[model samples]
Target: MRPTLTLIAASTLLLATACTTTPLPPQTIGQCNAEPASWAIGRAPDQNLIDDVLRDTGSRDVRVLEPGMAATMDYRADRVNIDVNDRGAITGIRCG
Candidate 1:
């Protein structure tokens, strides 16, 4: 009985040591700057314009928000959101 208990204790200790957690590597987070893309405001939103906005803002993604559209409240620094009015004209440009 003593040998069995010792073996079990040793196994538990070995398992615990093997389960150690390693620190994760640092990640590069993208930050969007809306100032450069401000030129897109009041302009129509198309694939070409959206691409330009992304390039100008240094954003990883773009979201076009039209009137009455439902959007998540989450803020992402790597995203650019363009708001359009009812007439399909771009109204505002922002970075989230």
Candidate 2:
């Protein structure tokens, strides 16, 4: 009986795992025509950099996130996220 119970639990766990999926990358930012080079990926995200992104991407809601920071998982078609590293260099640009 114990062996049968273990088999049943293992099967249930396997089924649940198989049914789960990885979340897809945000598509809203991927669809934006904003040039990646325009944001200066290796530079600091200062006011001028922020202004450039706003002016170029035309996105009013821009979020600047430091490394390992927790950000909302919600998707915003009109929002842009700037990821910076420890040295304050821009690492990634994505749309929320």
Candidate 3:
């Protein structure tokens, strides 16, 4: 009986932790979808900047693309793509 209770408790704890979801900052498609160019343009894609955007937009994924670079064709609803020019200035922002 003790072993069975311990196993059940352990399983319950594991399932609870696994099912938990961290809350994300609120983001709207109309706003987040239009934010990339203004946020990244004339700015470098540094870690700090990336972290800021990720926090602000609550984006699940971010991809930075340089001029003429090819990216995966699969689209993700939770992703934001930042396109930069040769000078490392952001030129476009799109959401997938």
Tell me, by lDDT, which candidate is best. Answer: 1
TM-score for each candidate, following the candidate numbering: 0.69, 0.59, 0.58
lDDT of 3 by residue, 1-96 (tens): 999999999999999999999999876553345364466666888888777665565567888899879899987767777778898877776776
Model 3 segments more than 4 A misplaced: 1-37
lDDT of 1 by residue, 1-96 (tens): 999999999999999999999999866355688899888888899999999999988888899999999999999989999999998888888998
Give the candidate number with the greatest TM-score: 1
What TM-score, to 2 decimals, does candidate 2 have?
A: 0.59
- Candidates arranged by TM-score, highest first: 1, 2, 3
Pairs of residues clashing in candidate 1 = 76-96
Q: What lDDT does candidate 2 reach at residue 44?
A: 90
Weakest 10 consecutive residues of candidate 3 by summed lDDT: 28-37
**2 versus 3: better TM-score goes to:** 2
How would you encode candidate 2's per-residue C-alpha lDDT over 1-96 as one tens digit per residue? Answer: 999999999999999999999999765543343465354678898898887886677566788899789888998767778889998888877766
Model 2 clashing residue pairs (backbone): 76-96
